[model samples]
Every structure is written in structure tokens, then in C-alpha cells.
Target: MHAHIALDGPAGTLRVTGAGLPAVELVRAPGTPADAHTPIGTRRAALLTLTVDGAPAVIRPARGRLLRRSYRVDVRVGGHRYRLVPCSYGESRLSRDGRRIGTLESSGDGRVSDAWDAGPTPLDLAVGTALAAAFGTGAAPWWETVGDIVGELVAP
Candidate 1:
């Protein structure tokens, strides 16, 4: 079986709705101060927090190298860690333990589709969808942009 959910509205006031689940509205939390010593291009340089349902969840750039053109972010909720990686054409891959469990597509009306057996719970789906919407495709981190600029400058 497959489950589908729709995400609507902007980042601060996004709404998530789907079958068999209550509609949830995610509110973007205020920006947290970044560590003064953490340099740009590091994971701690950029962070986002959202109020999922009623609980607060922090979203941070995941460590490690970038996946081609995609950027990754990590979030923990209900003691479960989830990663959201934005793919080409406005689709974000939602995974846990390196296994893809769901996908969030941002084309037209935003939607999240997942395999029922391997996918996250409805609450998780909502959280993942919200995170994907907040950090959609084509939004590269500052570090990646800096690297691109340096690469172009060095190329023959």
C-alpha cells in the first residue's frame, strides 16, 4: 500500500494533510544563534527549527560531502532520526539509515508519497514534508556556492 500527503503554504505557516491523519500545520521556529566559532560551509552554520504539531524539532545541515547537486538536512523527532535530501527537479528524498523510505515532490502542489510498509508514520511524514518544503530543491548551501566559485576560478 502507498500513502500520500499534501503540503501547502509557505515555510512559516505550512499545512500538511492526508488520508487517515489529522491535518497538521507547521510553524517555523525563531532562528537560533549559530556558534560564533563554527565557520561557514560547516553543518552548524545553517539551521532551521519547526514546531511539529506542538513539539519543537531542530533541522540542521547534515555533515559529509554533498550528494552531487543535492543538499541534506537532519532532524530528530520522537527519538527517531530522519534525513531529508533534496533531489533534482524539486523532489526531496526522505530516508533513515541510508534507505529511502519516502519522497516529497514540490512541483505544482507539494505532495509526499511513501510506501506504507517501509514509510514513516503519519506524524513523521508530516514532519519530513515540512522540512522538505522549507528547504526545497535548487537552494544550495553557502559552502557549495563558495566551492563552485573557486572551482570556476581555478578551471582552465
Candidate 2:
């Protein structure tokens, strides 16, 4: 998949397009936190609406509280759930039930590179590409880390 994100407007939007998979656009919610600064470095997150071929699929967090060395996010499309976690060198691995399916890489620009070793469901590609867009946004505010810790403490 090839992805592009628009960050200059009032809302951050990510669009992904590729062969076989329907085009997807993830629009970040107005109040969703998009970046955070941790003790290690910077991280990013977003609550986004996933749209495939102009049809809405789901609204979910594309990335979660992360440390400098590692990142993880839970994503669900249709009834299938997956996790996108940091692997190495700005790359993220997409897995389902502990089995690897695809890998995503961001160019640090607005572009993203993605590949799947096997056939992937559309929702899978949509969520994975959206998460990659969130990662491309860089970091959140340093104070956001405080909220992250507090959120983690209260979350069950």
C-alpha cells in the first residue's frame, strides 16, 4: 500500500491506495491526541474513522500509549482484530493472533510503504495503513506523557 497524510488543515487525514485493496481514508477526530513525548523520545496516537471506498468501517484508536523503544496498538476491522507493533528501524509488523501477516514502513514524509506476504482483508489493510499514518506524525507533547501514565493507571 501507498499512503499519504495531510496534516496542514484543521484535521489530520490519511489516505491509502494500492492494488486489489480499496482506497481508504482515515480522518482523525477533532480532540484525539495525535502525538506525545515520553521519557525516551516521542510517540503518536490517533482516534480515526476508517473509510474504505467511501464507506465507513469503524472508529478506533490507531495507535496507543508508547515508550521510546517500543510501540503497540490494537485495531479491529469487521470482526477481525490485529495488532501493529514496532519491530525495527521505523517499521511496524502487523499480526493476527500472534501470526505475522504484513509489514508497514513510513517515509517520515507523508508517504508510507507497505506489503503483505499473503492476501489481506480490506479492513486489515485499512487499519494497518491508518496506524502507519499515525506513526508518521512524529511525537506528542511532553505533558501528554503524564496523561498517558494516568490513563494507563485507570485503564483496566
Which candidate number maximizes TM-score?
Answer: 2
Residues 76-137, model 2: lDDT tens digits: 55566677766664677878766889988764455557889797776677667766665542
TM-score of 2: 0.58
lDDT of 1: 0.53
Instruction: List the candidates' TM-scores in order.
Output: 0.54, 0.58
Question: Which prediction has the highest lDDT against the true structure?
Answer: 2
Tell me the tens digit of each residue's lDDT in model 1 across 60-95.
Answer: 765434452336777766566778776544466777
Instruction: Show the lowest summed lDDT stretch of 10 residues, model 2.
Output: 36-45
